[model samples]
Structures are given as structure tokens and as C-alpha cells.
Target chain A: MAEIAATASKRDVGRGRGLVAAIAWRSLWRNRRRTWLTAGGIAFGVSLVVFSMAFQAGSYGDMIYNATSFLTGQVQIQRADYIELSRFEQTIGDATETLRRVEQQAGVLSATARVEAFALVSVDERSFGAQVLGVDVERERQVVNFFDRLSRGRVMAGPDETVIGSGLARNLNADLGDEIVVLGSAKRGGVAAMVLDIVGIFDSGISELDRSLLFVPIAAVQNEFGLGDEVHTIVVRTQVDDSRAVVEALGHQLPEGLSVRNWDEVLPEIRQGIDVDRLGGMFMYAIVLMIITFSIVNTFTMTVFERLREFSMLKAVGMRPGKIVLMVQIEALLLWAIGVGIAMGLMVPLLAWLQSSGIYLGEAIVELAKQYYITDRIYPALGPASLLAAPAVMLAATQIAAFASSLRIYWLRAAAGVRAAE
Target chain B: MSSDIVVSCKGVSRTYQEESVPVHALRGVDFEFARGEFVSIAGPSGSGKSTLLNVIGGLDRPDAGTITVDGVELNGLNETELSDLRLHKMGFVFQSYNLIPVLSALENVEFIMQLQGVGPAERAERAMSMLDSLDIVDLADRRPGDMSGGQQQRVAIARSIVTNPVLLLADEPSANLDSATTEDLLQLLRRLNEERGVSILTATHDPIVMSYAQRQVNLRDGAIVEDSAAKVA
Candidate 1:
């Protein structure tokens, strides 16, 4: 029957989303090269952001872990005036009890108490002032990262043995097993002096940490200075993710005179340093995303301009101008999804390899990094946040451009647009 | 359907400012059609044939006149309202089959119903049925690029009536078709008009179209010179 009917055909129907997406899909495939190129730009942009973000976070993680775990433990309990004055008189009296309390606290990984004193060390009649850290042998090993920074003979073996800095040893012209005399003021207002064997030497990449720092057994330093069971500070290592909880618990348990300081509080400068680094990284992310957004705007704008007839034809077929705009936006979003999907696919394996093997920037950086109390190897870290963040930013950015380009549709006359060639 | 005037255009005037010269496309034209009529507006080029169709189909607004389609006034409707009105009540067939190129022929047919809020299964079934009526069901899944000129026009016609619009407006629908295809199209349209009682308004200079139309609207210089009703042989 060759017949047409304008009678209502009644039945429930769905706008097969399959059909619409298929059309969108087909439209993209029509110009596969351009589609790929546009999508490629987004993928490359996202990947760069992801890679850089992961790299920065990884490096910072290493630095923080090393600095807090070794050079300065995550949390430090000190006599309130010890950090400011560094005088032996402002010491924590009976620090062993405080150390025992902190060590038993939940989330506290390890703790060490130290008697820090400034003294004069003389080698071959050449004397130089040095900062000596008197620590318990087993506790010191547990509290600090000695493996990465110890470059010479070994850690201290006896109360009479001392570990000096590479720069200090160089200046003293001292070798392992050589004896040096340490002179300092005893707590009872008397001159105290002792001769110690140099058992080990450490080279921290930072000139300052290596130049004047030395480690000695707590017994020997206490005997030399005549301070009995007195320590300047207690350094505690806390679980990184649990530091807040640990700090809260520590506040309630510690004695009145000993003050607990978290890594952020202990190294506000380093915190600021990290914030600055993050700011720089974020700036780069913003710049890259902006460029990608404009590229999307330009590409979709040209697409809208070129598909004028298609848009108008859609309007003629009873599609609203707003709907036409939506179609364009959806198209851009599809492109974004494609790009971000490709980025995630490639980055997953890439990041895993980087985090495992690590990137060695240079020997100089590796060496210098030890001064900050972090490792020499810098790894890339792609966290869940960055995995979601890069794509989401790209998606939102591309959508903004898609919407902006779609505004042109509102101005297009269906009659004129249906006749446009391109 | 009753003989109510499905479309009524009275004293419709349209003037276009073409770069500086004002061209009067339609000048005080009066026309109307009942619900189940097959009418043609026949004229030479520049006789306001397409212009008259555009105004009646709610595609173009007249400068001075009132047009009522399926009881809705086109004069007061906004762009969106007019678009909705067109989507549900008025369907158009352009001289060049303007099927969305990316859509399959069946999707092109389903386009109007999709816009009219028809569900997928129903629109698909209806679109297939519509294509069957036009003898182009085989071309349903083929995009316009892959279809012949005749098949594309069939798909265009199918798209126009898929929503069961009150008025089907054709502006030279057969302009690009060969004589045989034109005959086939007219015959299919004639069957639709006679059996299903669809009202059709076509603007064309083709003699074959005039032969199929029950009523002929003759326009000269944007005004109706003669309005005549005749029987098809």
C-alpha cells in the first residue's frame, strides 16, 4: 500500500540513546584524523599534567619522609625553651620517663631522646667548634635514617666512639680510629673534657648538616658534661597519615614542660617550601589546561561554523536551538572522554614503573638531597587524586569551551543555516 | 477529520531587506486549507510560492498578517513556541532533502517523532512503518550520503509525517527528483491524502504536481491571482 498517514501512531517509545550516540560517534569518525588530533591534544595535555603532578608529589613525599623520619622525626617533644636557647640548663629533667610515655602512645612509630651540646673538638692542634648529639645507640639507630647518609666506617660502637661529619673530618684532617678531644662546660659549673675515637663519618649533601654535626653515645656525653639522665629533646616518629591522631593523643599524655611539635610546626619553612613548589606545579597545570580549553574552543567553534547546515537542518526537523547547542557540547565532552581515557590507560603503567624504578635526576641532587634528610632517588607518584583530577579539570574546561562555542547556534537562522555549504 | 481550516493565513505580507533594496516576497496574500485537503500553491519563480509555504509552516514570520495552524496563532508564538508548534503540528519537506547527514534513513524518518517526545521503540516501529509506506524500508539504516536522491526524498517525506502533523508543507519536494520518482512521490502522497486523510500544502512550478493537487493556489507577485479546485485525472 503506497500510503502516507498523518494520524498519530501511539505507542511508548524511547529515544534510543544508542541512536543519538551512534550519530555523534559517526560524525566524529567522518573526520577521524581531526577527531584524533583534537583528542590527542587533550590526551597529551592531561598526561603531562598527570606526569608532572605525580613527579612533584613523589619528590616531595621522599623529602618529607626523609626529613621527618631521620633528620627530624615527625614529632619532637622538647623542653619549651630548648629549641630557642639550645642551652644545657634548659634540658628535660628525667627525659627517660617522657620518652617511655611517647613510645607507648598509639600511632607513635619510634622515639629517641638526645642531649645536644656545643663543644670544641681539637685535632692536631687545630680546633673547631662542633654541635654534638648524644643519643642512645639502639634508639638512635631506630630513630634516624643512618643507612642512606652513612658514607664512612660505621655508626658509633662504644660510649668513647664518635661519628663526625665529612666536612668536619676534612677540616680536622682526622681519619677513622683517630682520637679527638671534646671540651665543653659541665652542668655543675666546671670545665669538662674527654677524648673520643672517631668510629664513623657521614656526608649529608647539605654543607651545614655535614660541616659541624657529630654523634656520640649519651653515656659518654652525660659523663663528660656531668648532667645525669638529662636530655635536651625527644624526637618521635609518627605514622604519616595518623600524625594528627597521634598529636592529639600525645598532647594529653605528655608532661607539662615537654612540648610536642609536628613536622609542620617543626619545619614551617619546609612546609612553606612545599607549598611554593605545589603552587608552581598548580600554575603549570592551570596554564596547560587553559591552552587545552582554548584549543577545544577553537576546534568546536570551527566545527559549529562548518556544520552550520547540519545545525540548521536539525532545527528544521524540529530540533530546538538549545538542543542543537547541547549536541555540540556533548560532542566536545565525548572528545574529552576519549582523550582522558587514553591518558589514564597510558599513565597507569607508566606511573607504576616510575614509582618502582625511580628517576635519578643527577649525582649532585642525589647527594644534596641527603642534606634535606631525604633519599637520592626521586620517584613519580600518580595518586587517586591526580588520576581523577586531571581528567575532571580537562572535562570541565572543554565543556566551558563547548558551551561558549554553542552560543553561536542561538544566533543562527534556521533558513540560512540549512543552506550553509560547510 | 472535519473540514475545519487546519491552516488559515490572512493578509500575510513579508518584505526582505536584501542589502538595501527591499524585496517584497509576500504582499497581502490570503489563503486557507481544510484538514484533509491536498492543495498546491503553483507559480513561477519569485511568485512567493516558497515564501508562502515558509510563513504557513511557521518557518518565517510575516510582517503583517495572522496565521493560525491547528488552532494555534503563529503571530504570538516565540521562536521556541513556534519550533514546538512546528515539531508537533507542521512538518516540512525542503526542495533539497535536508536530512541530517549523519543519521541513517530510519533515524531521519524517526527524527520528527523523536523531537515530539516519542519513545524509541515506538518511534523505531513507526519510522520503519513510515519507510515501508514510502517503499524505502531497505534504505532505513543507510545514511543520506549512501542513499539515492529518490530514497533521500522518501526519507525526508517519512520524517515529515512521522509525528502525524496536522499539515505537511512541501516546498518543491520533487525539485531534484526525476520524472519517474516525482510520479512515484505524488502517487504515494495522493494515497496518503485519500486513505489516511492527511492535509498537504505544496509549493511548486512542476506541472506533474499540479495534476495531483485537488486544489491549486495560483500566486503572481506575492498575491493570489486565482484559487481553483480541480479533479485529478
Candidate 2:
């Protein structure tokens, strides 16, 4: 029969999705080079964003870990006034008991108590002022990462043995096995003096640290300073990256005069640095996505403009303008999917490799990075946020471009369009 | 508003703005076509033949006057309503065949039914049956670019009439076809009109297309100068 009748079945059965999508998909390949170029632009932009996001995440995590591990640990419990004043008289009185309590808290990986005092170190005729930290040897090894910078000799195993910074050793003209005399004011107005054997020398790479920091046994400091078991701070190593939670949990259990501080509070410089760098990265990414969006807008505008007659013909045969617009949007969706798919195909394996094996910064760059406590190697992170953020933004951008370009269909008069083709 | 009249246009006037000058495409035209009748509007370029078809098909609105298609007034209908009315009641065949280039012949035929939410199995069946009737069933999977102009026009006709519209409007349908292909297309239209009881209104200046019509109305400068039906009656 020449005539075909309309069926009275369900009005919303299929909505011609397959046919419309097929048309939209096939229409992209009509100009193969333009399609490739547009898709390539999307791929390049998305890949750059995704890769950089991963790298930023990985490097920032490494920086935070290193910064905390060096001396601050992930969380710290200190006498309330000690963090600001750093005086020998203001100290945590029952520090050993407080350390034990903090180590019992969930997410507290390890804890060590230390006594910090400013003293004069004299080896024969040479004498210089230095900041000496008296720590529990085994526990300090577990909590602090400064031992990783040890250049000579072993960590102190005797009460009177100490490790001095290389710069301090140079100033005092002291060598390993030399006995150095430490003298400082006592907590109660008497003389605090000690003679310690220098067992190790470390170069921490920071000029300030190398010039004046030293570590001795906590017993020796408590005996000489007349403070029997008092400590200035208890450094905590948290089990996970969420140190604030650990710090909060530890805060409620600590003694009345002690306070717990997370890495962000103890090291605000790192947080501020990350925030500023992230802002800059976001601005750069926005510019990249905006340029890509402009290219997409141009692409769809030309696609729709060139097929004016086809769209008008569609309208003439009873297709709504909304449906025509939807078709164009579907084309945009297909294009984005192609670009994202290609990116994922190439990026997943590469990011996996980078995550497994980090890229090493050379010796010169490592020395420069060490001042900020960053490690020698950097890894690209492979996480859901890094994977999804860029593609999601691109998807939204492309859809907006498609919708903007397709608005011209609303102004299309089917009669004029068809007549113009004639 | 007669039940037998498929379309009615009264005192229709249309004007176009060409740059800074005004051109009257149609001036105070009155015309009507009965159900199941084959009629042709014959005129030269700029004589308003396509303009009359466009206005009657509800693709364009008249600047003055009223048009009623299949008993519904086109005067106040919104774009969406006009689209719905056209989808269910009217079909159009353009001079250039204007088939969606991405779609195959059968897909083009089934597309209208698809838009109407017809079942896939049934629309495909009907599309294939329609193509077979047009004697081009073998070209069903071929795209328009691969088919001859005659074959493409046949597919276009299949697409337009597949939804069983009450009125089929053809604008210069034979303008791109050779003499032999034009004759074949006219015969196909004649068969579809007689067998399916569809009302057809074609706007053309071709003598062959006019000769196949039951009634011919000639236009000059946007006004109807002669009506064969009025003379016959």
C-alpha cells in the first residue's frame, strides 16, 4: 500500500531516540577532519587538566607528609603557653603520662615527648648558642623524620650522648666522641649544666636548622635542668591523612594545661601555600576550558549553519524545533564522549605507571625542594576526584556551547528556509 | 469550513521585505480544495505558486486573511500547535527532495512515523511496504547521496505520506527531475491519490505536472487569473 497509517499504541514508546542518535552520530563524520580536530582539542584540554590535577594532588600530599614528618609530626600536644613562649619554665609537668594517653587514642600511630631548651655549647675555646631538644631516643626515631638526614655516627643510645647539627659542629670545632659542655639557666633559678658526648652530626638542608639545632637524651636534660620528667611537647604521628580528627580526639583527653594542634595549625604556611597555588591552577584551568568551549561553540555554529536546509526540512515534516535542538545537543554529547573516551584510554595506563613509579627530581632540584621539606621523587595521584573533575567540567561546557549555538533554530522559519533552498 | 473541503484560504495576502524594498508575494488570494481532489497551482517564478502552497500547508502565515486546514483555523495557532496540526494532518514534498542526508531511504521513510511514536517493528514494516509499492525496495538501505534524484524523490514522497496525512502539499516537485523521471513521479502521485483517497495540492509551473491535475489554477503577480474548476462548474 502507498499509504501508511499512524498507530494508536503508547505515545511515549521510544521517542525515536535511536534514530535521532544515529543521525547525530553519523552527522559528525560528514566532515571527518573537522570532527577529528574538534575532538582532538577536547582531548588535549581534558588530558592536561586531568594530568595536572593528579600531579598537584600527588605533590601536595607528598609535601604535607614530608613537612609533618621532619619534626612537627602530624599532630602535636604542647603546654598551652609553650608553643608561643618556648620558655624552659613553662613545660608539661606530667608529660610521660600525657604521652601514654595520646598514644592510646585511635589514629595516633606514635608519640614522643621532648624537652626544648636554649643553651650554650662549648668545646674547649669555641662556644655558640644552640636550641637543644632532649627526646626519648627510640620513640623520637619512630615519630620524627630528621634522623633520615643523619650524615655520621648513630642516634644517641646513652643518656649523655647527643647529635648536633653539622653547622653547629663546625662552629664548636667539635667531632664525634668529643665531650661538649651545655649550660643554661635552670627552671628554678639555679645553674643547669651538662657534659654530652657528640655521637652524630646531621645536615638537615635548612640553614636555620643546621646552624642551631641539637638532640640529647630526655633523662640528661631533666636531670641537669632540675625538672624531673617535665617535657615541652609531645609530637604525634597520625595513622592517616585526616590528622584533624586525630587531633580533635586527642584534645579532649589531654590534661588541663596541654593543647593539641593538627598539622594545619602547627604549619599554616604549608596550608596557605597550597591554597594560593590551587587558586592559580584553577584560573589556568578555567582559561583552558574557556578556549575549548569557544572552539566547540564555533564548531556547532558552523554545523548548524551549514545544515540549515536539513533542519528546516525537518521542521517542515512536523519535527519540532525543540527536537531539532536536541539533535544538535546529542551531537555535542557524542563529541564529548569521543574526546573523553580517548583521553581515558591514553591516561589511565600512564597515570597508573606514574603512580606506581614516581619521577625523581635531580640532585640540584632536590636540594632546592628540601628547604620546603618536599621529597626527592614526586608521584601522580590516581583518584576519583582527579579523574572526574575535568571531564565533568568539559561536559557542562560543551553542553552550554551546544545549547547556545542551537538557539538559532527557534528563529528558523520553515517556509523561508525551504524556499531559500529552492 | 465544509466537511469535504480539506483546505480553505480566504483573501490571503503576503508581503516580503527585500532589502529596503517591499515585494508582494501574494495579494488577496482566495482558494479552496475538496477532500480526495488533485489540484495544481501553476505560475512562473515570483508569481506566488510556492508561496500559496507554503501558506496553505501552514508552513508560513498570511499577513492578512484566514486559513483553515482539516477544519482547524490557522489564524491564532502557536508554532507548537501549528507543528502538531501539520504533523497529524499535512505533509510536504519539496522541490529539492531535501531528504536528511545522514539517513538511509527506509530510515527516511520511517522517520515521520518514528516522530509520531509509532512502534519500531510496525514503522519499519510500513516503511518497507511503502518502498516496495514505490518499486524501490532494493534501495531501502542506500543513503540519499547514493540514490538517483528520482529514487530520492520517491523516498521523500514515501516519507511525507507515511503518516496518512489528510493533505499532501508538493512544491515544484518536478523541478529537479528529468522528463522521464517527472512522468514516473506524476504517475506515482496519481496512483497514491486514487488509491489512498488523499487530497493533493501541488504548486508547479511544469506543463506535465499541471496536465496530471484534475483542476488547474493559474496565477500572475500573486493573483489567481484563471480557475478551471470554476469554469467547469
Best by DockQ: 2
Q: Across residues A35-130, which tens digit of lDDT does each residue of candidate 2 receive?
A: 999999999999999999899889889888999888889998888888788788998887678778888888888999988889998999999999
Give the per-residue Cα lDDT of candidate 1 at A304: 79
The per-prediction tally of clashing pairs is 4, 0
Q: Candidate 1: which stretches are off by over 4 Å? A: A1-16, A85-87, A123-125, A147-154, A170-181, A185-195, A222-227, A256-258, A360-376, A419-422, B1-3, B229-233
What global local distance difference test value does model 2 have? 0.89
Estimate every model's Cα lDDT from 0 to 1: 0.81, 0.89
lDDT of 1 by residue, B75-181 (tens): 97766666667777777788888888888898777767766667778888999998888788889779999988888888888888887888899889888999999
True interface contacts reproduced, per candidate: 0.33, 0.65
Which lDDT value does model 1 have at A400? 88
Q: Which ten residues in a row have the lowest lDDT in candidate 1 chain A?
A: A1-10
lDDT score for residue A57 of model 1: 82
Best by TM-score: 2
